[model samples]
Target: MRSRYLVLSVSAFLCFITLCNKSNAQVKLANLFTDDMVLQQQDNVPIWGWDKAGSYIAVSTTWDKKIYHTVTDASGRFMVKIATPVAGGPFKVTVSDGKPLTLNDVLIGEVWVCAGQSNMEIPMKGYKSQPILNSNEAILNSSNPNIRLFTVPRGSKTTLQQDVKQSHWLAASPESVAKFSATGYYFGRLLSKMLNVPIGLISCNYAGSSIQAWMDPETLKAFPEIKTPAPADSIKEVSRTPTTLYNAMLQPIIGFGIKGTIWYQGESNYDNPAQYDSLFVTFVKILRTKWGMGDFPFYYAQIAPYDYAQLPPYNKGGKYNSAFLRDVQRLDEDKIPNTGMAVLMDIGEQATIHPPRKQQAGERLAYLALGKTYNFKGFGYQSPAYDSFTAKGNSAVIKFKNAANGLTSFLKEINTFEIAGPDKHFYPAKAQITGGSVTVTSDMVKEPVAVRYAFKDFVVGDLFGTDGLPVSSFRTDDWDYNVQ
Candidate 1:
């Protein structure tokens, strides 16, 4: 009996040793650690992967050449932090437990996660329905190896994934730029030219995705109105389903260090525009927490003017619901720190939702990042926003911020100003720009209690700052203006 027990114990020990050998032989790195990738500079970026439990892994970067080490946990997951140099690299990252896995042609530079709906997902090659403006010229000039691109595969899973199914980082060329996000590519190219550093863009966007679809489930639970149907057992269209894209596309790259994020979405959430203030604030908070990056720059484009109300041709008669959605996005500037909105009111088309002038939108976003986050001086990134109003007897004096250089009318006359009294019936108000403030008065309104500018679904308002940025739509009241 004792001899039989010894033989059984030896067999069990051998099996355990075999299992250990299998685990050790299969050291794998996260898919994010790929060739032609970019890492955030001047930060301790995490280099992580799987190895045998209790096995020590060594990590080194070609830029620094200092070796760092860490051991795998009981779950066979290992992560090591490596310091990156300043914004410049065509370096390599090497990790080893028993065998070395190397990521080559890596860049250490500014990396921004460009994420949102179809507007952001639109490629430079132009959509089947909407052709991008100046795309041919842009594509021809886009053969820069320093500008890298990585587009997250569009799909959804109910559960969070440690790695994306399949993806690759490609150096920007005419062919690659045609397939990548137009806004993302333009933004990166601008940064690369201005900052003189390699720019890496992680395009993690999907068409027709709502803000709820990109938010965490736990965060959405607090706002029941904004949350979608709960994640199910099987995968569906994650872009449309709440929390699915966050689980699949964003969750895998949550810890991957990035400089900031630029978003272009809101059409999908226009139905619940009122709740967007809270939902968007909550979304930014959740993203900051998940990324463990404190208040990183978050810039977004205001929803462009679209005929969502299906107004008749040559008709500006609509509920102006999309205008309200733009207002909600603007409110984030006051509610959250390190946030900005790119006003695309003038660039949008009345007939189509996808505007052709995407370069202007992208350049506007880059300007915000440069001026606000990177401390670029003398850079005009903001438009003249409505600051305050003073009722002066018959007329209301509307002051504006960012109008230090004064405001100008692109048209022969200033347009889209409406004034109302206690009864709240707005009528066209004659507006005249005097210095930095506009004096608005109407023969119809005796005592103007409220003022609105460009507060319609589609309006070609001529108000602009001397810097040439258009004025965003604004109203000084919180009235429930939904006409649905």
Candidate 2:
């Protein structure tokens, strides 16, 4: 009798093990494909998951009730590209491999990745002791089912991760918007209103992350000095560590369909400004290649004006000034294709690194998208960048490229202009509006070889385009800050 019972128990245990193995092979999708997710519209967007190797699966979209088929690869990963319709959906997408898994409330619309450091991570509710200008009002009025939000939680690892652990897409409501990225929310809000379509904004950011942190190993290989974190190393700053953020945070969501990415980073990389110029281009190129998307609209914010040297002891100056970093960001626009930058020269705060006015930053990015990406005409989106300067004598007349409406100081005295001779010593210069250009001259510095506008650790920009957008901090000379 005991032997018979033992045999029966063994048989049942083996059956249970078989059942568990079957369960392990169940179809599983990336966390980004959760309910309420949005895919890019009018494109072949990817829908992927894992199942038994060699298993065939069928994906059905409710928008058209069409079935797309694919076979899982040797690694148990299956991916199928489906053609999405124009921006409008609260449809269902179902995947089946014997058993069916369905995602509800799926949207097909403009999807944007909103990424960066603390400024981008700051929520609509505002951070403690620091507030986004008119955040409360924005949050209270931020209810719209047309907008969707998702945030990738903070993580860092040495190896590439497959998917996020705890994440879901939430429809924009007062409750959800309060925790969502302020810049992302504002940007999406404007897009939804202007385009009158569903808008999805993914907040993928870590506070105080360096540019190297977002770069992949292949992209950073050229820079030998930047090293990845090892298992044995004790990490003090997880976000600042190279490649770890890309491994854990960015890697998991690489192929997700995105219209483009809007970034507001570079504060942490301010100490090394020159390298950021080329690194930014390499990062953007590799990212587009990985996504298999054509050069998409890649708009980013020029780091806001702040007293970066005033973080602690306030002794930092010269080479550590963040103006160089902003300049590199400006130069990146020329290096990369389909790129734009929202200059924040007017909104910087001297007391805090987090600027209170994120709405302007977000809206500026939207204007770039509407004008450049969507080809919406009229109204200025590009800031008036310094174009060419002609030095006839002591006075140098600087021409701007996008100042079609001409430049203005709003009747305020412009005191930030500086003129420098070949010796590299810059002196305060009197700037006068010369029709569409600005002519500057300094009594102290004759025969100026270069000109700088609002070029300092922290300066409230007084110069602006007639469209109300401020000119980015600029310097014509490539000399290092300590060259003098």
TM-score of each: 0.91, 0.93
For each candidate, the alpha-carbon lDDT, in order, equals 0.82, 0.86
Candidate 1 lDDT tens digits, 1-484: 3211111233443444444454436578887778999888899888778877887666667786566666688988987777888988789887766467888999989999999999999999988968999999989988998899999998677766778768889999999999999988888889999998888899998898988888777888897665455445654555777888887888888888889999998888776676777888888888998889899999989988877767333323333467888888877778888988888878878888889899989999999999999999885899888899889998999999988889988656876899888778888889999878999999998888889888887666578888888889888767667421
- For the record, the alpha-carbon RMSD of candidate 2 to the native fold, in angstroms, is 7.8
Lowest summed lDDT window (length 10), candidate 2: 1-10
Model 1: lDDT equals 0.82
What local lDDT does model 2 show for residue 422?
Answer: 79
lDDT (Cα, tens digit) per residue for candidate 2, span 1-484: 3211111233443443444344445688878898999899999888888988876666778897666666788988888888899988799998766567899999889999999899999998888988888988888888888899999999988777887767999999999999999998888998999999899999999999998888888788899988877756656779998888898888888889999999999888887787888788888899888888989889999998788777654546776788888888888889889999999999999999899899999999999999999888988999999999899788899999899889999999999999988788888899999767999998887889999988888889999999999999898888867843
lDDT of 2: 0.86
Listed per candidate, the RMSD to the true structure in angstroms reads 7.1, 7.8
In terms of TM-score, how similar is model 1 to the real structure?
Answer: 0.91
